[model samples]
Target chain A: GAGVSQSPSNKVTEKGKDVELRCDPISGHTALYWYRQSLGQGLEFLIYFQGNSAPDKSGLPSDRFSAERTGGSVSTLTIQRTQQEDSAVYLCASSRPGSNEKLFFGSGTQLSVL
Target chain B: SQQGEEDPQALSIQEGENATMNCSYKTSINNLQWYRQNSGRGLVHLILIRSNEREKHSGRLRVTLDTSKKSSSLLITASRAADTASYFCATDVRRDKIIFGKGTRLHILP
Candidate 1:
């Protein structure tokens, strides 16, 4: 892909339901990141993947939130027993190597838990 | 949590005027970057300034970084209606992780 891609641009699910969001990063990019943004709020880092190494899961909000990057290309974010406060736009970005490298972002998945 | 804070949460300006936004961070950083986002859209990288560099220019955008003060500023000259969007500043600390600010909303009026 020419840029980062996310699936299901908008999602509305009932509270306590599980939701899965997908992301496809650009080819050959070694770094990928997941973030959540509340309305009019700053981005909250969720996780990071560098190649196939151990993912940086330090930012995952809680045990209900988990993510995985398969084959270093596509990634998925899963939220179990979602809460109303969990509603937000989940963003994915990819970069070349270093943290300072420019990040290409996807349009994001707006998950709404009603 | 966010690593940086941006001031003037919102700014409304007429086209052709300059728009400036400031960002301040706590810890030392390797580099700082500026990004723009339209409504419900992904962020677009605008400019980046390395710790070793003080200032950089790209088209109508100018970015300045002061590592000593742990602050940075982005200046958009001759802004246009198309420039109406949310501006964000991200910091890369030691190449570990990238942290973003709350962002400044700029509304360029025609």
Candidate 2:
């Protein structure tokens, strides 16, 4: 793809339901990131993947939030037993090898937990 | 937790005027980057400044970073209506992950 892509632009789920969000990063990019943004809030780092190595999941908010990157390209973020506080826009980004490389972001999935 | 915070949560200005947004971060960083978002969608990278460097310019955008003060600023010269968007500052602190600020909403009135 020309840029990072996220599926199911919008999702509405009830409390205690489990939801999964997907992301497809740009071809050949070695770095991928997931971020969460609530209404009128800053982007919160969730996870990061560099190639197929172990992911950096330091930012995952709780045990209910988990993610995986398959084949070093597409990624999935799963939230278990969703809570109203879990409602937010989940963003995905990809970048080249270097640390200062520019990041290409996806449109993001807006999850609303009722 | 957020690594940076942008001042002036919202600003409105005439189209031809310059728009400036400031960001301050905690802890050290390898590089600082500026991004723009329109209509609450994805973000677009604008400019980046390395920790070793003080300033960088791209077209009408100028970015400056001060490591000692742990702060950065984005300046858009002769802004246009198209430049109306929320500007964010992200810091690459070490190799962990990029931390973003709450962002400053810019409204350029035509």
Candidate 3:
């Protein structure tokens, strides 16, 4: 793809339901990241992936949140037993190695747990 | 906790005026990057300043880094209506990951 791509631009799920968000990073990019943003708030880092390995998962809020990247191309973020507090926009970004810190972002998935 | 923190949660300025946003980080960083988000969507990378470098420029955008103070600033010269967006600063504290701050909402008055 020309840029990072995320699926289901918007999602509305009930509390206790499970939700899966997806991210497709640009071709040949070696690094990927996941972030969450609540209404009018700053971004909260959730995870980072180099190739297919996630070296930093310290940012995941709880055990209910987990993510995995496969084939070094697409990634999935799964939230189990979602709560109202899970409502937020999940953003994904990818960067090429040696690009310093330049990141290309996807539009993001807006998840609303009611 | 976020490694970087942006100041001035919100700012409104007239078009053609210069707008500046500042970011402060808690630890040493390899580099600092500035991004712009429109309508709360995905962000676009604007500029980056390496820790060893003090300043950099990209067209109308100017970025400065102060490792001694652990701070950075983004300046948009002759801002335009289209320049209205939220600006974010991200720090590459760890070589493998980057953390972002809340961001500053910049509104350009027509």
The most accurate candidate by lDDT is: 3
Give the DockQ (C-alpha) for candidate 1.
Answer: 0.69
In candidate 2, what are the lDDT values of residues A1-114, reduced to their tens digit? Answer: 788999999999999999999999999887899999998778999988888664578899999999888898898999999999999999999888765458899999999999
> Which consecutive 10 residues in model 3 chain B have the weakest lDDT in total?
B91-100
What TM-score against the true fold does each predicted structure earn?
A: 0.97, 0.96, 0.98
- Arrange candidates, best lDDT first: 3, 2, 1
TM-score of chain B taken alone, every candidate:
0.96, 0.97, 0.97
Candidate 1: what's its TM-score on chain B?
0.96
Which has the better lDDT: candidate 2, or candidate 3? 3
Query: Model 3: which residue pairs collide?
Result: A42-B102
**Residue range A9-111, candidate 3, lDDT tens digits:** 9999999999999999999998999999999998899999999999889999999999999998899999999999999999999999756378999999999
What shift in Å separates residue A62 of candidate 2 from its native position after superposition? 1.0
State the C-alpha lDDT per candidate. Answer: 0.90, 0.90, 0.93
User: Distance from true position, residue B48, model 2, in Å?
Assistant: 0.6
**Winner by DockQ between candidate 3 and candidate 2:** 3
Per-prediction DockQ comes to 0.69, 0.70, 0.77
Error of 3 at B12 (Å): 0.8
